[model samples]
Target: MATELTAPPGVRVDAPAIQRRTVRLLFVTQIISGIGVTIGISVGALLARSIAGTAVSGLTQAASVVGGALLAVPVTRVMTAYGRRPGLVLGYLAGAVGGLFVVLAAVRGWVPLLFAGMLLFGGSTTANLQARYTAVDLADPARRARQLGLIVWATTVGSVAAPNFAAAADATTRRAGLPEYAGPFGFSAAAFVLAAVLLFVLLRPDPLLTARRFAAPTGAPDAAVARTPQAGAPVGADAQLPVGADAELPVGADAELPVGADAEAGGPGPARRAGLLDGLRAVRSRPDARLGVTAVAIGHVAMVAVMTMTPVRIGESHAEADVLRLVGLVLSLHIAGMYALSPVIGWLTDRTGRRPVILGAVMVLLAACAVAGTAGHHTPRLAVGLALLGLGWSGTMVAGSTLLSESVPVDLRPAAQGLSDLIMGLAGASAGAASGFVVQFAGYPVLTALAAVAVVPLLALALRPVPAGAAGAR
Candidate 1:
């Protein structure tokens, strides 16, 4: 017989077990999303370059960045009202729609339509990026960063294969009788639909809801607690009670709350605070959160600024196949650097500190700029430079996100993440927009120098003296 949870009607059972299941489901979901996203990425800029002038190719991804940034608040708001499931599903669906638009644009040779498709396609990237947050929604504070990083690392499984699959996608063009680049978007659309379906069917007993019920302390189960003398309970495990009796948490939170919240006010506690303005105040109220957001936003600007123009730079000299192959190789390496070592990055965030990692990211980005800027057209050196860019981006991203999540109250976290991601999106969008103009006028070397300069604020902040109760704590 199913053990009836003796806790209040709303309370849930087996949170740790449920969280594990949630992570597994999310991992599968992320792999599919990774494939969908990278497939589009492999072709997106290149297609835009062909359809429009190279000057505007950067605008393709830039438009997507803007779209994703714009959706942040709305997506998070949906999560707040319903749950992570609905929000993620919506994001993927939007991406699917965007993919169709891209195909339409390619078929018609319409620049506007391609930009439109890419902008909405940004939703896929948004979903891919946000998947990491789901893993830690019910994570223990001590192990939160590690778990988040592990989920990010999972994306590497599908993402690594994505660029290589460009050939497969190209072959798909022959079968589908579509434009060459549109083949990848066709693949992208199908993958997003499959991912959405899997999540809808399998992500049962949502983890965030269950976690809230467990955290709420006020209500009692209908039945009385049966004091059964069972085998010794594990330390910090739920108190031993009747088999069906509701289990209560200790006086305070021993581990991290889902999404960095402490605990939901189950009883007559403070009502949930939401909305754009409230989120801004919540962030501004906390010094650590402010700094964390700044780090994340600046890191994104540097990464995107350098990354957006890379295909254009190398493709100027190579044949179509060579350009795609080399760009694919370089991109795969850069993306690999972004997520492959996140488990270590997460562990180090816990072991060392956020500030140190932030500082390290600055140094790596500086090195990447130097290598790529001076290499002229050396493919090997450029590849290495891009990979370092990914590595440096990974460090700041994981560490900065962990710190931001940890610093905020649980109830306010959705809004906080929305706010931070919005800022990140805007920064990336701005850098991307300026990137083409810079490469056109000042040259790629100056563009790289600009990216290097973008790291200044982050480095300066990291080097500042941290006070007690700083956001650096694991």
Candidate 2:
């Protein structure tokens, strides 16, 4: 039997080749998964409204968001133990089951079942969110955002198109005895299944595992120091791990450095496994990493708050005959805004720096709120505002994600990354749940105003001066 090739000391491996292959596989899988997720999200609120009424309609989406956050723990654990391929496959498969449950719930008008299904359906989002991180597991630091952005961009096709197919999917499923709003979810379930199968079959060499294999120590004397854990910077109360893969410690600072694959794997003397609190501590130890998590969380909150209520707003003022078409078009545009320009955003993040792009995102989000808030029933204005909302979301997500990934050492990256997503997802879930009440009581405009206010902290954080050591890592 043939063995896999390995890179020896002083010989750089074909990491670029592996990275390219990984990106291609991730891109295709992202498209498939994006379609599944967007189809379900597009009508999740509407379905909830039909069964549970507007008062609690937001709960379904909130459940999904929370599900995505909660699921990240296990999914990332899988990634940490096994590899990216299995982790992603696990998430997608779970999502497929959730989608089916949602369809069944919709048909039976079972509110509890619907929420449960949506929560499980959140697995797809978990997989989709993590896929971006997978793209950069072996990427060059300089082009990290660009590569991550490409995977994000791939979602544009499926996400944008899926909303437009809402009416068609609804009609098709209705004929098959499914409820009006349940057809999209039926399609969503099948899409998730296909996505899982595709990844299981073609995501070869498992990018995270491959990167771990290549990053193992080569027994050089200096490499020993890199692996040694020093007792400073407070990564955790009981643990003192590395500051980051590329972080330069200050004078007398005892932060540890990157670990080789041996430490990551459960070798004879394996390193301690990082927990969620450790990941939070890791973020706390670095200014840039804290800012990264903040940016992603705040951006997600603002986007979800306003978006969760838009369909409801349109339904209120628009003619019934036009509601479906307008909702689909607006959501399609919003989804496009979120994903269509990600590549450019990624390139810009790499060029101008993550902080600048994050600041820009805050500005765009505020602009989105301003435009959307005042639009009233004007369809064109609302569409444009939603587009800006998505654009801002893309900018923050790409830059923040890149900064977080690079700001932590490889050993702690998965945990930190998962924690960041958890925070972001929780923020979004809060916003999503509150949006319905805000819109119901104060109107859609008020919801947008609150969403705008949420970005203030992110703006302040982005404007803070970067320390010399942290700046070097970016």
Candidate 3:
């Protein structure tokens, strides 16, 4: 039987058990929180259109993306200082508050209030995104992608189901003496609260803190150090941390791990404040990591640019009275595509390699754009195209995220991850904000084509040769 790994200083722990417990808790959290976020997404734009105008409809999603990106700074710092549990709990509660604000905004027909609420609502997404990172805190290197994918896959149940409930949520709120559009946000607020309480009560010992303890030498001083590279130490290729895996990280992450070498050799050293710039530098210093960020950012931007404008396209093209219901159904199908096959995407990342999968994802994205661009009022083709778009996003997100996590040394992982997410959020925000204007002028087909263009750079980067000693680069 394989020996169970334990932390040092006479404090023993079954790493596998902790990991399992962590995954389960996070999975449940994802489901509950997923419903909260997706419910808002299904109707946020339409709600904005009711109060504001078509040009500003996309601002709701943009605000959420911006909120998530900006929030990542403090959340990452909290996780760095305290641990995952506190940070995650904080994020969820903030999202719940945001949901309340959104409900109030709808009641008052206030666009500014709606945007503010949407920003706060973004906190739920931040927590959900960060949870994936938490899952890998103590994961076996060999199965890291699969474990990460599982948490993402768990989101399918809630995300796919939430959109279908749009009409029900609307009716429920109408009966409650509230605006129909306000129901989803109100229900979402309750969901976020539930998720926060669950983490606060059950997420014991903290995955990140435990992982740090396990990574430390058996009797070495507390490894709760900040993840800054040592002064005068090399932060280049020679400092690469190895990860055992089959495929390289999507675009920039290395798939190759030189086992048996000290992971800390020339890597991040003694504790220091790992500021955002430091995190950015860490990713920049590593070729594979840099590429991973590129993949994540571009893929996110492309997905957001297309998805945010889709409802408007459908509503404009179809004059049906049940347009809202149609929007809800279509979004449900799109979300299903995004999350339903995550495990398979994760497994493929492990089996086929990150680069191949990412490249394939790029192709899939391009195809989605092409199909949707020409689909116009053709509901079936649009649905198929949106589904493909979701599938492509899943591939990039899983593979790119896994690569980002494994590329850096454990100590530096949080900082690097924070930087990556921040960039990704910003990229998505830009796309969301611009999508409105683009579609307003150039049309939806033009927007899809532009989104497709944005990902070409990532594809080119993924095809480039890996640098020597890059982690997860096979």
Candidate 4:
């Protein structure tokens, strides 16, 4: 119930506190949505393989990847216009529709229809990705990292359960005399519906709006505005203003302004423009951003390369269908590693800083690539490599996100995040398509080796000393 305080035009002051209920609701909604998205991804690939034959599965996946890349800009614009809630709700609805189409395609064995369904379903996954940004909207500056981390961690529940859901779908569909492939899509649809309902009902008052309302006052003298409730009250309640509510006092009347005040004190115009320009400029001028982007982009390329090629490679080696099952298992393990330690990564970033984590993650990624490139033909070794790859991905992703957050002001955060995700989507899409070609020609080992080499410049950049003023630039 703290009084709403406006900072300088573009600078946003951290809110007094985030409500526990709000956080819990957002977390739960994201978890449910994540499960739906994962189910779609896990099953969609298999369905594509089934309908179009293994030879064309890569093409189908590439279509979905390209679809995701195409969707990013429009999705971000929608979120900007309507706020994340409506965008998310609409995204879920789109996914549900897509799921139904998948089920229909499976019933009819329509390859083109199945591919179209997958492209539509990809929206769900994109929406879930945007959920992390929403989680940070209401968080205090001091707690933003942890808040983002928590949302990322929440995805673990869904990711870990997704494969089981796929298995359940397989069983249930067969029992019901329906096409086996339809079951996962059905389950995905239900989960999306549930998530949509939860979001519609629970995300009250809008976290972003609440944060804006509760922020510390800016520019005006303390005496001009009334003090609101205690620091710990629920965000939107009205509190009593202090005695001199209308009286203007000296500029420095109160000591110990809230956190993020310095940035807030500057008038909004310059800061807003700077925040926008800073993110773009960082990509161009700062080695850290550039290197981080390169590492992530290459890691994604390597991941898609090995992952898309694995089942084919195993089949060529005269492996059983169970080896395909092993791919699913490995993927599940990989996802677990990617999301399970997010909170820990967030805490570490907050405590130790982002550069060290980035460097460490790069090292792990390098090692993982080496393992996959050399020893991964063996089952056990492959499993280990995939797990390490997942862990490395998690570290780099969390660290990179934290770094981006630190580099940009809150107002421009959404745009910056959107841009980053767009880049990632493009990179992942290109990699997914190219990996198949690379494996078709160059072999998996060479592809992984190239991925390993991609990280070297990033590592070198991480090793460089920060200039004196760079610390404050963020």
Candidate 5:
């Protein structure tokens, strides 16, 4: 009976060839898509400031958040039905169209239309966010977090180049007598179109589909097929079945073993089908998840609120050219901070526990906020604060994402992640717009103070102990 039993799900499962190919293709496509996304985001606020002026700059940031929130469900449904390839292709197409509209808006100097275009263009970011899940679609549970982290790190290449691309676009616009932001949007459109083509043409058999196929039962015998004990059997043979033909077990009546007879007697267990509600329940039940989510959500709110306004504030104080360069530098540093530490963060989560990293991130962000508040328009202080903010964001995001990954089963991962991202986007948008109003009406110091205050509860939650059962799961 021990030989007839199927191997444990994770112990012997091998990734399908198609799944490997899909991961490679998606990695390439995502890198290109990242470039397009970076271009759009790098230039978006500048475009808004140029066209809509200081009063409605927040609307640009708000458009992206609203688009992400609105499209989260639909995007998840697309990935569910058509698979990741088509969903990604369609998303890039939408982004291309949106980029065109942005260019037109810039050429015509239409603020509302530009905002609309930004909303549309920003929908692609939703697709980009989903890209990490695609990387882990067929990965083993032990390697899933690492695979996700690798894909995220891949985006660093594009993100690092994005500011330079935006700068080039800005220069091109001046030389061509076009609107200041037209070149970036045009370049972004081309990049999206290219990525869409690559995804449609190269991503074959889809990683998600491959995972589903591998998980299905083959209708083989239910009894464990135990191998003949050789002259030398490993000591752990009692605990684990031998690989291949070594552990053939008897069939029929001989296979009938007493229940709970041996630790390794059972065949592969049923696959876990975690649904959306299941993920939510996991989050609700896990104190660690709750604290991690709170830290991420609040930290994101503060980060976006301050980051969104930095360029505009700098522009108000310095020349447009100098301010744009400064904005580009800050954004580059921010992206570096966001993605560069993901692998290390994942390792830390696996080793040191999620709470310490999360709490430390919140403390760093609090310090950043305080620094930003007291900088009194000092560029160096602002730069330092922004860099720290990026570091804090990285820690929180990696820890939060790792926590979320563990909470949901493979099936529900995409939807649950979408929901989490959607909520983050909503909070970020609201805070960003409110920060603008606060900065305009009150001052940057007041805005930063409010963000610092919001971090307090997150810190408390991060420090709280998990229940005994919950701790066991971690």
Candidate 6:
């Protein structure tokens, strides 16, 4: 399988083998970046409370999510023009810089700066999300989900270790004599920087470009025609198709896209840089693409709404020490479920069909909501529920992401992916903003009920018939 992917025409290198190496490199980089992202996310609320005081602490996460959503535009634009390496490297670097600013905010007791930094700090989140797409870029179509899953699974290692860094973070604070929360952010900054360096140095040949080469058929005369624009280029009018509620099916169900179909046409389309609106417009034109984007966005909304509040529910009853330990254990299991078992989900997506996996995710989310909604102070019930919630999220993530990548043509891929993440971040932010009120007013069950209900649209969308011509439509 590895050797079969020898260079096509102009290229003489082993693209598949290089892709494998890139995956491995990204895997290791994600471990470090994952830790960086987790440390910031874990401590953001606490730091907000410490600086801004408890009154507005809740908005810290919302700000971070918003920042991440907004950054997807510029980040993907860069990727569309340059390549994954530049976009990813820039994201981590921005996050690393954000960490430093947060440290400054802590020192000056500036709450606004703290939010600003946390917002920029969300670049790590963007990088992490984008990295999943990169994993599938040069991947074998049949094995696409599996490759993405492995990267997702790799993050579990660092995430599970992140909370433990509180001690280390504290130690750094003492040694540096900075704010109590400053140490972890400092450590996160370093991780982000290192990740950037690795991507710059090691992610050679650019997987997306390599995949384009592989996508061209063996002997078609005009196989090298360009379908999508390169990172910054525009699509041609003739190659364009309208996408929306009136969306057309791709080519055929799960069809192996011709090189030009997804942007490997070798010829450029329009002359402008792609942006968020462009991405949304592209996905909207294709039915299957719309489903993929919808699934990812709604799935994220469901997960964040409940997961963000679970700790608060536990903190409501448990002692400080018990709450810390219990939350750690529960969150660990949840994060693990989100990633550790992803390979199996990917395999299932490949084997059972994307729609089944999506429906399964919805079912799991429903079950998670049912258990978590009423569990309240009960330990076992809540733990299992949170874990299931993570699994459910993973199911949607893997399947939906794969579908999104495959359904769209390459020129649109970056923008489409960026749009997917932007919507997802916004959805998560909305959920985070609303969860607190819902829980405080109507109770945790109400919050879970809302989360469950949020997925109804996704479920309905998935149930719609996929067009036979759409690649991976089912």
Ten consecutive residues with minimal summed lDDT in candidate 1? 217-226
How many backbone clashes are present in model 6?
A: 24
The local lDDT score (0 to 100) that residue 94 gets in candidate 4 is 71
144-229 in candidate 1: lDDT tens per residue? 67878888898898887787776798786858788767888888988898888877666655444333333322311101111232
Q: Tell me the spans in candidate 2 whose CA falls farther than 4 Å from its real position.
A: 1-12, 43-58, 104-110, 163-186, 216-272, 471-474
- List the lowest-lDDT window of 10 residues for candidate 6: 1-10
The weakest ten consecutive residues by lDDT in model 2 span 218-227
Q: Judged by lDDT against the true structure, how good is candidate 5? A: 0.65
Q: Is candidate 5 or candidate 6 better by lDDT?
A: 6
Candidate 2's error at 337, in angstroms?
Answer: 1.8
Expressed as tens digits, the lDDT of each residue in 257-364 for candidate 4 is: 222223345322111222223445545555545554555565565566566666665565545857667777767677766778888877876677677777888888
Model 1 vs truth, CA RMSD: 7.1
> How accurate locally, in lDDT, is each candidate?
0.72, 0.77, 0.76, 0.62, 0.65, 0.77
| All candidates: TM-score | 0.81, 0.81, 0.81, 0.78, 0.75, 0.85
Error of 4 at 49 (Å): 3.9
The lowest-lDDT stretch of 10 consecutive residues in candidate 4 is 248-257
| RMSD for each of the candidates | 7.1, 8.9, 9.1, 7.8, 9.1, 8.9
Error of 4 at 232 (Å): 17
Name the regions of candidate 3 deviating beyond 4 angstroms: 1-8, 46-58, 106-111, 164-176, 216-272, 315-317, 322-329, 374-378
User: Model 5, 76: alpha-carbon shift in Å?
Assistant: 1.1
lDDT measured at residue 312 in model 2 versus the true structure, 0 to 100: 88
Q: Say what the RMSD of model 2 is.
A: 8.9
How many residue pairs clash in model 3?
9
| Candidate with the larger TM-score of 3 and 5 | 3
